[model samples]
Target chain A: MTQPIIRLEDISKIYGSGNTEVRALLDVNLVVEPGEYCAIMGPSGSGKSTAMNVIGCLDRPTSGRYYLDGVDVAGLSDTELAHVRNRKIGFVFQQFHLLPQLTAMENVMLPMVYAGISYNERRQRAEEALTRVGLANRLSNKPTQLSGGQQQRVAIARAIVNRPVMLLADEPTGALDSQTTQEVMAIFAELNTSGITVVMVTHEPDVARLTRRIVWFRDGQVVHSHLAPSELSQTAVFS
Target chain B: MDMLESVKMAVKTLTANKMRSTLTMLGIIIGNASVITMVGVGQGAQRYASEQFESLGPNVLFIIPGSDDARSNSFDLPRNLTLEDAEAIANQVPSVEAVAAQLQTQQNVTYRNRTANTLVLGTTPEFTTVRSFDVERGRFFTDSDVQRNTRVAALGSELAEKLFGTANPIGEQIRIRNVSFQVIAVMQEKGAFLGNNQDDTVIIPLTTMSNRVTGNTSPYGTEVTVISATARDEASVNAAQFQISNLLRLRHKVTTQDDFVVRTQKDALTIVGNVTGALTLMLAAIAGISLFVGGIGIMNIMLVSVRERTQEIGLRKAIGASRQDILVQFIIEATILAAIGGVVGTAIGIGGVTLIGATTPLKAGVSTTAVILAVGVSGTIGLFFGVFPARQAAKLDPIVALRSA
Candidate 1:
């Protein structure tokens, strides 16, 4: 149907050279369509993080073709790639990497700072994003003052502040307790329901079940791909 | 990103660790303060020396016997300058305004019961004009008194008061070297010069001093001590020196090395000025080393900051910051530190100058050039020292940095 939001073909990533070389990824192919919620699940050292990094444009694949929103990003220069990340991909790490010195509102406004938005508009959009994440009254509170779930919410607000094409999250709820994880998952689910595309990597099967589709990786290669039961279709399943 | 925003970010980061930032800036502060203060003091010393030289006279020259080398070597100076030579210079040289022949001897003076050891000066009536002496009461010795060898003397202000207290001593007789002489005039006040008291001496006719008091020791002519001569004006000092030297050479019948030397007030001023100026430059240079150390301190602290903020760098890069952005951010932080230190240090240096002026003879003088140069140098030092650490931060790979963190 429509062009995929992200398309990867024959992707392979090598860590080192000669005897010490480790193949982090091997001939992996994947496609994510618009308004879709996809989860990548694998054990530790299964190349899930490498696949996430590649999808987020934080790292270039050793040999592959990556088309993000219709442009070949694998051949882009460093500056151009940075611009693409700023304009196209939003990142949310498991650590909730918030600058300690900045307040919640300032942290959320950081991405737009590189987007060259006007000061008034940047502040307005940041306030909207914080409010959307249920942090309206906590705008002036620094990251250390916020709880783990609230900090993740702030990180999510920062990720989407630029209105990037897709949100690339790596274990967004990995650091939270069961209740906080549900709270964060609710926010992501709500954001996804509002037509945002989300690509997440998590080993938890329950977390993967919340997404519309799941891709399973083993030994640096994707071994299975299928739609969740609700959206299951025989032609969409891969074995 | 906007420069204003970058500066805001830098300021925020710096304020987060207030004590460390202040300690980092302390080196620059002390370095700038010392440079400014030393230069100010040096300039003040130069001014003081020039004023002292100007106080000697408008355009005066001292014709001392023997060369500078001979005086420093402690060689005995020939008593070659005679009264005839002084008279000849006065009449023969047009550039020579007035000349005073002086013969000085330390002797004890007694006025009734009061006795004080003082210098008895043998001089002519032209002494008042050549030495800038004013006759406050009565008048100086006339030429006729010199011709007749009259036993009359003029009292300096301090000596007049010492011998007579508030009482007038113009007509009183005082015994010098156990010989009685009448005081003809009382001079006005003149303070000390080069640690020697000018108002503590007695002036009398050279003829009386040579013939009656200290008998002529030189067999060649009426021998006198140093001759004090004045040029017609500022422009005539060199001409007067040249003419006087030639006249003395002929009068003494000198061949290879002349037996006399003429020195000008300007010459002495030049020598003193050079010495103080060089000293000031040396002080500034020494203080500059501290500024260099301050620059190194900035580099050291910046390096540590970059290392500590490796994770932050990765976060910023992931948020779409380019290498240039990180570089500019860190560089701006360093520049702000140095600039703030420079300003505060200048203020402290000005305060120090004021304190020095209040506590000492030097006036409160601030060299604007020194202040500007110090600030400029510190800013440049910050930039120069900041490049390495900033580049290190900018060049860090986002994946490696985030993973390390």
Candidate 2:
């Protein structure tokens, strides 16, 4: 097998010290191979989000060996970690955190701006990303002007604009209706099929069923893992 | 972010909240305008005073007897000015162009049945030349009039119009101190000089005024109230003043304190200059307080802006904006507000000064230094007030900020 794209060994995160200490993650050991589509599910405060944050490099694990591709994240400074996040990881949020002041295309072009791409080139790349998400015609529309499903599509366009190594999405469809949720899941599956590794956090089993594999978390540890059928139904499944 | 992008974003944000931005800028605008206008007015006053003094001719000097001694010692003072002393100075001092002695006294003049209070000046034939008096109607006193002590006088133009009405005053007799004197010439009108109305006076020969008017009761050889001297030109005024002072001291035989004071046109200009300079400085200082208040307004608005854009700051940081980028963004916002306000304020200040100058005699002078200072100071206020909010925004943690949104 090819080497895992993401490797976490004995990862743990403690919230405080001594009596007040809360272990958000405990000895979490996992590896995600290249191009894998995986889903993590847990009840509230069960540490699934915490694990996702650690994997995304948004937070540091108290004790761990986390390797993205091959480099250990524990040794990187905050600035270095930010660079890693910008260059390698893309993020999608449940609330669809598109800047209200910016148009859809501008929101998608944010990462490219930070990367110091020339203005014309950035615009070209952002337009291409929006086209991939079927939003080429709505490039000038603001987030408030778009529907819930359309906003999430813009968020996905933003996520894949830089062609990052991993797409880390936390409840990417939590706020969408059943129909919109299916639309968002279809976009995610399409991206995954195109050779992008996608790690998503969700409590909905229907959402999890769209991915190739599901890892369940309870009390800050992964409790069960299962594989879904290669051909799954696209119809809404609430439970 | 690049500077261009930051500036563009700042302008966009400010324009989005138009009313708040305008109100915020109002403070700076008013502060800048007040400072400019007040300073302009002060400068204009100084210029006006200097101009008035310049119109008085720079070579003229006044010698008033008992002026210095009257201030220090009142008992042993001598009124030692005479027509001879005036002649001696004209001959002895090479810088002196002309010297004219004058004896002044208040009297009631009767023309027909009408009577008016008027000043009587006893002077020589050279008084018209030395005092810059123009002949509006008839000629002035001649040498024959002074030598013969003729019972004749020249009426000033306003006094002529007042006492004679439409009738010609030449060859007419007017009663002065109950003595009838023939009006040989109707003198021209001279406007107010140093707050004294020159048109309200009658000029006659000095010998007639001394021997016929009041019996020359003064003990210091035909005592004169003031002696008027004119220098050859503007360049010789200082030398003329010095020479005249020395001549008068010798004539009075003063060993300790001189009996007279010589006031030059330059000395009057200096006094007016000092007063106006101090007034300008005081007005500028008072206006400076408003600028400081304007800076505080900018600070308050910036703080509010920081609070309102907290989530935006967090999002920008998450997307790779450095601390300096955040700081620069906020600072740019403040700078834009202050700079625009400064420009508008300058226009308003110029307008205000122009309006004042048009309606009143007070001049309103525009100074480039005042404009530059107002604009530069407002910009500085932006930087000063912007620092605290920019620092706070820059220090926000991206992780926490992301979590907040």
Candidate 3:
């Protein structure tokens, strides 16, 4: 059996209690198989970002059985969660979260540093990942030296340099122009095509249309799991 | 994550904000520098005092006529000591290398209307050797001169200049109390000691001083004020003292309390050393306060750094940096700042010490222990003060940090 790279079972994340109680996720079940490119789309106050946080291992669900690469990670401690995040999940954020003090090569080698990889191998792999993203000559350039699209490409290279099981992006192209957005999306599509599982969180219908699967959230539940962009207007997604 | 990587990251971060890093390290620099310089100054003072005490003459002992308590209680001490006692000590004490007795008196001397009252010191020929005073011009009085009661005198450098300026003082007739006395020698310049000027005086033979200048006031044979002795070597000082004490006690026929006291240069040196040592300690302690303040400064800067780098910290955590890794990185940054400050401060402190050595009478030496201690203490202060900010950074929630950023 080929185990799914991500499996979320009966997940519930509630904030506060009594009158202040806010249910971010309720009885959610999500399974992302290997090599799948998926997008989680929702309107504001739809708990899509909270779900992304849980799936990225940045926050824990109140009640759930989360299995990443077939291992139950719901009960892991913060340190162990950190280890799982380092070895399994690679995150690309909306702002291109590259450490400003470091160059592109150093930024990409950061995840490998946490993994205790050899320095020379980390440099070699970072070079390969940056070159694959069409940044072969900009290895030593800092984040300010790169354009918005180039910065996102460096973030992508950093995210994939460790060879993680899943490449998780939260609004990966949110800060880029339409042209740079398409450029970043193409890199994600190429990475996903090469057997790297990709899960993106975005509200744009156009961005969601690029993914094979679009999971729509309403309030705290996944209302439409298989919605096509052409039919998104037909359903009351905001309601 | 690892030590090497964390250190590298810390260096990069510090280099990125050069102004902030240097400002954060200023406290440590000032603290260590003051500590080093103050300690050096204290040691220099101690050495200066030690040399001053040592100039009193090595292996020399002074046998005062009366004991300390007796001298303190009575303003007029019993004039029972005599030249016979000094002679007895010189003959009886095997450890005694040389002995000289002094009888001091103030008298007026006239050199062709240039009359001035001056201190007259009557001492034997051995006084030059025992007291370490040298004769510069003519010869000092011999034992035969003392036996013959020669009416001759040696003039101190300042007194010779005062009485016979431009003209040579040798063979000049200087009248003391209207009695003619010929100047035979001019004594070399000996600086002041304990506020008393040694060069503002005249020296004469003991026999001439007792018989001619000052009348014999004591019923005892040839009364003397203080008897000074030199031991054969440094090791023989105590032996000489013990033998002289026994000889004096027996000669004086003392049945109850002793009649004299023996004093050494070592005692005065010890007292001076203790005083200067305490002063040094006080100075060093004051400087150490700056070190404490410096540590607090480090803690303050580190706390600010944690707050300022919240976004970077959050991004690192999201990427995979553990709490321990972030903690190590922040701590390494603080320690590196303090350690660099310590080394720089040491260099400046050594420079300060060199400056003091060149400009002042003090031979200030760089104390190795102080250097080690200052550097070690600064590094420890860095490590100690770094814990709180590092812990705060480590405990920050990645999501909260990211959102806040």
How do the residues B1-405 of candidate 3 rate in per-residue lDDT, one tens digit apiece? 668878888899999999988988889999999999999999998987788768867798988877667888998777777888888988889999999989998999889989878989888999999988999999999888888989899999989989998789999899988889999999999976644678888999998898898978588788888888999999998888888888998988888888788878787688788988999899899999998899999999989988988888888888888898888988899999999999998999889988998898776889999999999999999999998999999999998888775
Over A1-239, each residue of candidate 1 has an lDDT whose tens digit, in order, gives 78799999999999899999999999999999999989999889999999998888889999989999889999987777778888898889889999999999999999898888889999999999999999999999999999999999999999999998899998998898988887787778788878889999998776777778898898899989888654564322221
Q: TM-score of B chain for each model?
A: 0.75, 0.73, 0.72
Best TM-score among the predictions, by candidate number: 1
State the local distance difference test value for candidate 1: 0.87
DockQ of each: 0.58, 0.33, 0.61
Location of the lowest summed lDDT over 10 successive residues in candidate 3 chain B: B191-200
Native-to-model Cα distance after best TM-score fit, residue B152 in candidate 1, in Å: 10
Against the true structure, what is each candidate's TM-score? 0.82, 0.76, 0.79
Instruction: Order the numbered candidates by lDDT, best leading.
Output: 3, 1, 2
The window of 10 residues in a row where model 3 chain A has the poorest summed lDDT is: A230-239
* Fraction of native contacts under 8 Å reproduced by each candidate: 0.55, 0.25, 0.69
Regions of model 3 farther than 4 Å from truth: A230-239, B55-58, B62-127, B139-185, B189-236, B239-262
Residue range B1-405, candidate 2, lDDT tens digits = 577877877887898789989998998899899889999999988887887777768888888777564846675546677777888888999998888889888988888887879999898888988877867766777878888988898898888889988899898989888888899887776676555678988888888888888667476577677788899998999999888889888888879877788889888789789999999989888887897798899989999888877877776666566677789989999989999989999899989888888886667878889999999999999988988989999888766666674
